[model samples]
Target: MDLIRDDDENNSISANPPEGYVEPGWPALYSALHQDPQYLYQPYAIWRFTLYWTLLFYGFVFLVTGLLLLLNFTKRHPRLALLSFALWILSSLLLGLISSTIVAYALAALYNAAFLRMSTWVPPLWGAVQVLLLIFSAAANVPFFTG
Candidate 1:
């Protein structure tokens, strides 16, 4: 089943206002009045994207561990197994949160851009900001786990 419906014909925001309706000067008001049609699908999208990425990352970790085990590297270096387990735990907790937050904010920014009629550069700039946030979070988290 499709999580996002392509019913834009029914969901499109009206350009013309109803009789006696006064347009507000505030962009926030416009956003409130004419929300993105895809707003309803955002939760599902975020959940799916987060789950997909988290599982992919988890799989990568597992694959590496399996390869190490196959090579007898884990037996030679017992600490490797412990490190792998710690990485799994970190992926379970931190990675899930990060992916979900990234998906949520990215979708929100996209919807906001569409509804607000923001400049073309705005979405990419917002995406860059999200990437920076992810990098900062990873940098901050690494020392705690490593040291």
Candidate 2:
């Protein structure tokens, strides 16, 4: 299988190359993974939905924990409180990591599709977006912080 090369002389481009000769890039990958290029939108939509629900769960937990703490729920049920705290921290951390991973995968999928153009800047921009979201999620509890 021969890879397609850009012919400068002809100034023409082949968007869909023949099968078995998958180009060593996102375009080829996108074509291979999806039967219809429009399906490329699915992963990103799912990623966003997951992030939204995860954040919502975190906010609900924070509120419930804070309210119970006011009534000295921890002192009454020390073990339960400790367990809840531990679980909340671990789950949130795990979810964040997983969310970032899914986002990265979605970005790769986008690259394979025609939605995102190939560029060196993509990696850094993606990293920055992930970092910013993590920071925002972490800071969501600031208003309830006793300290």
Q: Which candidate is the best by lDDT?
A: 2
> Which candidate has the highest TM-score of all?
1
Q: Whole-model lDDT, candidate 1?
A: 0.46
For each candidate in turn, give its C-alpha RMSD to the true structure in angstroms: 13.3, 11.5
Worst 10 residues of 2 by lDDT: 21-30
TM-score of each: 0.37, 0.34
Q: Could you tell me the lDDT of residue 84 within candidate 2?
A: 73
lDDT for each residue of candidate 2 in 25-58, tens digit (9 for 90 to 100): 2222234355423222234433443354444554
Error of 1 at 117 (Å): 15
Tens-place lDDT digits, model 1, residues 20-53: 5332221111243476312222333434444444
